[model samples]
Target: MTRARTSLLPYLLLAPSLLFLAALFLVPLLQTIGLSLTENGELSPANYQRMVGDLNFVPSLRNTFVLVLVVVPAQVVFALAMATMLQKLRLGRDIVLWIWTIPLGVSDLAAGLVWLAILQDRGYLNSALMALGVIDGPTPWLTYETPVALFFSVVAAEVWRATAIVLVILVAGLQLIPREYAEAAEVFGARPWTIFRRITLPLLRPSLQTALILRTVLAFEVFAVVYAIGGRNFPVLVGEAFVWQTDNQNTGVAAAYAMLVVVISLASTVFYLRALRTPPEQQP
Candidate 1:
């Protein structure tokens, strides 16, 4: 009996977490899937059909993909550079890092509102531009007619708000990398860029994979920031879901849109897991 209990120790410890996952994620997920696929007490694809048929569907999907493709890569590059710079710091590093990550404490809606204040007509950005003689007066940038500018505005706010998450993850991974390897490479006349390319990147694959998956997932789920900045001018998948649920009063269609988001998130995660997979030889 003692040996059996000892053998079950790890699983017993995991019991609460498993229960929490079931209660919080799995149950709701099953309900959503059911809700999305069923109609009048029968399983059907009518909700999905309705979702796809909505006029906003194509624009929402395109905008969501565009945002994810643009934002995730930008965030990764910026965070990686920031993390590398932070790693090179020998003094006041933690203080600087803490300052850098201050944005992480800001909620998504609050961050969006913060930027909206800057980007809106007659907002700080326009006032600064006018003062600098860059513009004659307030210009409407966050309008449907200015799609390109609105898109970029949302991108800027998202990067400012969320890049800190990737930075922290990469910093943790960089610190775990044994410094002796880098030093040895330096002694062998390896250049800084080469060391980063051949040494740092290869070792940082796990962290890169993690950051990519997380940021990509969030990018797909983007709603609040875009809503605050561009509103209906920039249609995204999650925003469409919200519109369906609240504005359209269509719960099934909203559930369908949500399932689509979950699918896209899962697909991106699988891509990263496979593409940036760590070799057994590289495993720590």
Candidate 2:
């Protein structure tokens, strides 16, 4: 009875979470996958065919991958740098930390819109540039199809909005690392970089893995910012999916795109976990 009770307790504790995931996530996912294969109550491959042949679809996918490739690493790097600085800082630490983390409470849509105002041709950026004589007049930012500029804008917005989340996670991980480890490493005459490489980063693996997985999964769902900044001129995968579903009312094709996005996100998460797996460090 005692053994069975112990096992039952864990299952009982897990039941709510399992049920929540089943109801909110799994069921909707299964329905979406099914919908992608059927339209008007008739099964068909027509949606997939359209998606494959859609001229803009391929480019949109390429653009989305490019955005992820640019944004995720950039956010991670910025987050790591900020985390290190916050860890090392002394004066005004609380104020600086709160400022760094303010974006955590802001929505991606809001962040995108806020940046949209700043980066738009007639917006603050252009106004400043014109004031400084850097440009004689307003220059269009969202209009040009220049890949570098478009990518930079997207990456900046994404990093600015999301880096705080990574910082919080990494900071938490950093805190859990004992100060004694750093002190001991210092006593051994380890350089700052050497201490980080040999001690801090190794202990930070789990937190890094969690942050990477979360950020990567969220990257696939990026829409509002891309839409606000690039519009259809420089569509990303999520924006393309949104256009198909909302604007075009092509539910089947949109479902297909959504399903693909889910698959890619899950696969990327799995890849990150495997790539970042490290042996557990001895804990004090």
Best by TM-score: 1
Q: Give the range where candidate 1 is weakest over 10 consecutive residues by summed lDDT.
A: 66-75
- Which digits, one per residue and each the tens of the lDDT, describe model 2 over residues 108-224? 888888888988888899999999999999887776556677668888899898888888899899999889999998998999999999999989998999999998889888998
Give stretches of model 2 more than 4 Å off: 280-284
Q: What's the CA error at residue 186 for candidate 2, in Å?
A: 1.1
Give me the runs in candidate 1 sitting further than 4 Å from their true place. none
Give all TM-scores, in the order shown: 0.98, 0.95
10 residues in a row with least lDDT, candidate 2: 275-284
Tens digits of per-residue lDDT, candidate 1, 73-170, equal 99999999999999889999999999989999998999989999998998999999999999998998899999999999999999999999999999
Q: lDDT for model 1, on a 0 to 1 scale?
A: 0.95
Relative to the true structure, how large is the alpha-carbon lDDT of every model?
0.95, 0.87
Query: Could you tell me which residue pairs clash in candidate 1?
Result: none
